[model samples]
Target chain A: MFYLLGLGILCIAFLFIIGLYNLDFKYLFMISAPAEKITAAVIIIGILNCIISILFFFGVGYLREAVKAFMEKKIFQLKTVLYFKRSGIYLSSCATLGFISRSLAIIYLRVDNNGSGFGLGYSSLLIFMLICGLCFILISHVLKESVALKEENDLTI
Target chain B: MSIYINLDKVLEDRDMKSHELAEKIGITRANLSILKTGKAKAVRFSTLEAICEVLDCQPGDILEYKAD
Candidate 1:
């Protein structure tokens, strides 16, 4: 069910944060830097990752509840619709913030701008999340229209 | 822009109460009230048929269009 899926996504995001903490992006930077600068970059990246993780939690939680409502045949409820919309925004923010954080870390280390992770060859998880978030938003729009139509149907004598 | 119900006028002419017509048509007085007040978004064909049969009136006699 979607509730389990949301939990899975949250776990994956947590693992992603841990992976980021242990990752050696400096090797990719391939440039010598002061210890303080390296430490600062790592700390900033960690903070951004934590923020992203928090947003992910909120997003996933809302998604879980929305899916629960949907399963209960309440998909057109305005609250559920708004929950989905908020979930989409939060999920998308996670991806965008991740891109910015990692890119900034790379830029800070390499003193260059070759750190963007949006290339086709890059890992697809962020892009996938972004697409998924957009899909949720689209679903919210469809549900909103369905709500109006359903009201009309119910009122029909 | 919306539908207008003329059921009150027909009921008046037929000297039949709304409750009686609703009972004869097998619908609730609340729903009949919705129809009478023109608050209904639509009138289903089945209910229209029942109402027409009960009131001995055509669908047009019970519903009107009031362009806004």
Candidate 2:
């Protein structure tokens, strides 16, 4: 039950990000810089967004495969383990890229860097992704043990 | 690990084949092979009973425990 709720929240956050992308962070920055800087910022942010989107989609694909394996009761197999582990790595990569890009953007845009940290909005999602990624890796380890036990049990007369 | 299967000895004594015992017990030949090779992790009571019934022997005659 809680797992479903968590996934729901993650999906909603993902949709919120898409909406934010559609809005295009132009207004989010209160900088009154020259046209050249503005164009450069747009290009940089666009490229970063593109990379992050690709990684996020790959992570989602791997997670969907893992979920399908669970639904089919094939969790005690190496294929399921591979799905979970790959998803975990992709998600962790997405979170890392998000953090690095956001931090660099903030520094480049000169957006009030008084040593304060990120806001509660997107940072929370990034943190959640990192945690979920680690959790998936852990679940994969547990499933590895389950696979061994299942093999042993099946061989038992 | 201390528990062992002595099914082969009893089968040889009765001049019975592994496939014959397996068919009698309604189990696959591969499963019976696992048992004969001493690779099975555990045995089911129903299967043990079936094997004993087919071989006309006691459970003790088929299983032996040796401390390692």
**Top-lDDT candidate index:** 2
Evaluate model 2: give its lDDT. 0.78
The complex in candidate 2 yields a DockQ of: 0.68
**Model 1 CAPRI quality:** medium
RMSD of every candidate to native, in Å, equals: 5.3, 5.7
User: Per-residue lDDT tens digits of candidate 2, residues A21-55?
Assistant: 53335424523546556666556765776787788
Q: Across residues B15-47, which tens digit of lDDT does each residue of candidate 1 receive?
A: 999899999988899999988887888777899
lDDT of 1 by residue, A35-151 (tens): 545566766776787788788779888988897897888877899999999999998998898678768766775534332332322234567678878888998999899899988
The TM-score values for the models, in the order shown, are: 0.73, 0.67
- For every model shown, the clashing-pair count is 0, 0
| Per-candidate interface DockQ score | 0.73, 0.68
- Report residue A93 deviation for candidate 2 (angstroms): 1.2
**Poorly placed runs, candidate 1 (over 4 Å):** A1-35, A38-47, A110-123
